[model samples]
Target: MKVYKQAKIVHETLKRLRVRIDWLQRKLIDASHISTLVERMEGIESARVNKGAKSVVIRYDGKPETRLAVLDFLDRLEPTNLPYVQQSNSEEKHFFHASLNGLALAASPFLTPGQRLALAGALVAPTIWEGIDSLFSGSVKVELLDAIAIGVATSRGDAITALSTNFFIHLGELLEAKTNNNSNALLRQLLHPAPTSAWKEQNGELTKVAADQLKLNDVVAVNPGDTIPVDGQVLSGTAQVNESSVTGESVPVNKEAHMRVLSGTIVEEGTLRIRAVKVGDDTTTARISRFIQDSLENKSETQKKAEKKANQRILITLGLGALTFLLTRDFTRVASVFLVDYSCALKLSTPVAMKSTMYKCAKNGILVKGGQVIETFADIDTVVFDKTGTLTHGELDVIEVESVQPQEWPKDRLLALVASIEEHSTHPVANAVVTNAKAHELPHINHSEVNFIVAHGMVSEVNGKRVVIGSRHFLEEHENVDIAPYEELIIRLENKGLILLYTSMDSVLTGVIGLRDQLREDAKSMIDRLYANGVARIAILTGDRARKAHALAEQLGIKEVYADLRPEEKAAIVQQIKDQGRKLAFVGDGVNDAPALVNADVGIAMPQGADLARASADIVLTDDNISGVAEAYEKSRDTMKLIQSNFKWAVGINSGLFVGASMGWTSPVVSSLLHNGTTLGVLARALSGVRER
Candidate 1:
């Protein structure tokens, strides 16, 4: 078979690697064979050939030696007629001669005494060498048992048995290492992500800034979801604080003005403005561990327990092999018993499952940073949303148009007249009015040059009449317009939170146009779906006035609302809900609510948010639609289910293989085949992704 003539690495990360193999698309090369061989290489977990791109994507352990080994293996690849590999000429040459030796051993009568011994010795030497190396390590390992098994067969002059056992031992160990390494990498990447940023109060205003920049005695603002970054006394505001990180207290303690708050603690409810007594390494968090290290260093107990069980099972395999030999005095049985190790299947499946789910999340436009984020996301029962862009469209829309004298100045004519004058302006209200006029296909009323007024409305002459379109003050006070008749209509519109724009013809008021920030068309529907899907609690956190914020919440049928909030206070409400044993997922503009996004169990950033805001969040929606929030939550739960299923299948199948090997029901080759077969099977299922069923 033809092999890849050349290779070039294009991109690489700690565990993920992509290489350009220019000759990969050549019809003469066996792409599948190359993939199989590269996957067999130590430290590599998987290899996929992309013929269209003429590249190979490899997942490997990022150790210097492992990376070097991979690079060297591909660089010197040789064309071979071998069944399942494409690698260095020397390795292929050795295996080619070994196969001939294996064939020669098949006809014992044709070989001389010295020749038979030489052939058997060459075939089992690698396995026997590994055994000898392990002997001085002062521990009973799978390597030692493998060597002894092959050695026993060689000593008995069973050349075929010896060679077969040797081959299986090498194959089994490679697969086992690949599986375990892949799983470890998944957990490693999941536990470490990014750093924390907080809001700091300086002078008179709160500025969203990185926590590391604060100095001792600087005032820092702490809110829900915020980890107390410094040891300080509260200058103002009140909050329910969780000091569990430092003091190990389970319940939250109240912190009000003049009360002390320690570093590394979290605000569960309300807000706090504190004077920093300790900052950076001098603070409690740094004393325990640096800020990033403290937050990013985490663990998944599921993987830990699986790993522990896997280690213990290796010893169990050794103990069983020894006991079987003592009971039956059968070398073949003992060798077979030594072939299967649960450590391979048990340790390998978890990471594969995690990586698969992570891929699935990314495919749906949700970027979940790490495994911990996925875990936390799956557990999220409470969702807190920042009011502006998260709940509403975050822009003004023309909602009401009324004419006092409908016969004299029709609603359509009045609206068109105002839009025509306001079209020249670029204010938010003007844009809303002009946009509405376009939607209605209203003809622009021909008017004289529009005179713009700063912070007021536009004035112009329409058909020899001076048309004034502006606020009540501008129309009634400056223009001497008589607007006394529409008193009830203005009050009714004002009570509905609409900003009324008035239009006066000559000196008499004609009509009123109202504008307000409208709710997103999908916002209410998304919330309904969230509750139906499993979100236990939902609340609104806003910088808007209480009346307006509560009004939006009521419109959306939500009860819990935190209104009249500063940017710093938003995350406090998130922390408060999170502290009550409910996992919180905060949806916000992403930048302004930096404190909340950093503090929530899972922070989902809207697509409209700035890049820095998206970077701070655990999950980010690719589209402006808030419906992606429900999609992320649902997908995370499904992924967790897939991981759990993979774990069960791995443990169940490997335990059976372990039993069959112990009972001598399987040969050494068969035991190795079954053990690795189960690993690949579980690995395949993990990569298959979560089926909707």
Candidate 2:
């Protein structure tokens, strides 16, 4: 096997050399405008043509015998069997050997242009011989052989070319992580903390890890500007980490100690030493990365069924072709049809088109995470969204202020005091109060004995008096404040989708501040377009209450609502949709949406989402608009159509060429030309998507 492989390599090199020299000679003529030389080479007026002296010959049988003789002479100078054979250590000798080797590879009859280029390109590097030797001597050869065999079985059109391309692509993938040259400085920086240990557990579970050390339940300090080295509980400190790459949140959030912190988050501020509860591959980051890698490599159940059917069809066709060829003793004819089936065109076309679309999306400030996600999006029939950060402006605005009597209270003064009490809070209502105070240039009033009622309101003393500012419930339940006449104002604000905050002094409702959450500017238009584009149902899923979800959905023309759901509950809702036989897509931008993104058939996370959410989602919209959801699906569907069209053309043309060859209508040279020409045509069609506006 080694001798045969070596001989074949040598033969191919010489054929490539001849092609290059022939090409260079033509270029020389073009450069100098040598009309007489060209005429002489054509042998127009000569009776006999010189065989080797700047001459050209057109032959019926492709001149294989003549090419073989030239290759035989080159082989005598240096043979693959002889280690480190060299006629001279000069640059010309190296070029001469390389060109000869390329020509020999090209002439092998088994190799195509792509195959020849890939093989010859490898020889230009110094490591080629070492790897080849290693493959021959070590058990690693078995793995390499398996990869090659898989390439052959799974590939269609030009077996050598497919194998060669796969080999180089895989090699590139392997080397990408290790290379740190100047040209790849940015890439190196991005993958510096690359996944080091990826392991599959005995129970068919996979995990990942980056750090060298991890201990059980030890509180690990994940400070600001630091990455979470392991999963742990936030034992101390107040910080908000961006886990968009891992979870997908468009905004950073305030996290206090006692909350569980997953691995792979960028702490924006504050410090929290979390107890290392998960070790090694069990960490969240490792598991997520492993999931992505597995999803990319392992065929989904649907894909497996499709592939099985494709394989059966191909096998049946192969059997029929073989039977026909044996009966007619026409191997060339049989090989032609087998060489150009639609599968190769489909594979290349879909990926190339998808990659191009992804690039286009990036240019437009949208990121479709991967080709696989794009494929899934093309099948979506419904899209669900989160309301607060996703649909609303996420900040409340104080639209109105009212008093018991029309002119009884100074609105600005009342708002100033409310803002003072809520100054230190970060809730939407608190922000609204602060904004109102800022807008009116209200003077600050120092408050003492300030106490926070979680998710209800704030209580404090300002101007040496007790004050209460919060919802109706907070006043009635906590401060025992009465609002007999303020009820009308509160009802009015609620009808407008606003939350009213009542201010009380000494158990009496003094005034009310009406704050409303505004809809996002592009929210309605984007959602409307999505509905027009065949989206049968659209829903809003949020952690907020039912009223909030329903109000946002009503304004955005979304009829469905799933509200007050936790992160895990959101994922369950997505799973329920899938169970109901609906193709569901989720659009979210929070750590809470991570599981939902992973669970949905198609997950479209905002580019601004938390690290975890972005990584979990298959597609990301950088524009942070809901309309991109529809656009992505449209592009994907178009890509799939192009793939199908290219596949049909590739298979159809090859089949016709095979039929022509079988009846002696086409010669070997013509068949070879047609075979490569069809492949080129398919590539051209695939690339046509690039010109799409």
Best candidate, TM-score-wise? 1
Write candidate 2's Cα lDDT for 1-693 as tens digits.
Answer: 212211123113322322112221222122111221222121122111122233232221235543443323222312221111112212223344435444544564776666654554444233334334546774232123223322332233343443333333233223321121111121111111212222222234334322444567654555566666666677778998876644445478787866666666667888776677776666654544343333233333333433454444455445545665787765544544344233333334444455455545544445555556666677788888877766775678888887653364477677777888888897878887898889889998778978887887777886666888788888888788777655666766676666778888878788888776777788898888777767787888888878757766788888899888888999998898889888888888889999998999888776445768877877766554555666676777776667667666766786686577566576433544455556556655655554442
Clashing pairs in 1: 223-572, 224-571, 224-572, 225-575, 268-576
Q: Which segments of candidate 1 are over 4 A away from where they belong?
A: 1-159, 169-305, 322-329, 463-509, 516-525, 554-557
Can you write out model 1's per-residue Cα lDDT over 330-351, one digit (the tens) per residue? 8888877777766656665665
Worst 10 residues of 1 by lDDT: 186-195
Clashes of 1: 5
Provide the lDDT at 489 for model 1. 87
lDDT for predicted candidate 1 compared with the true structure: 0.71
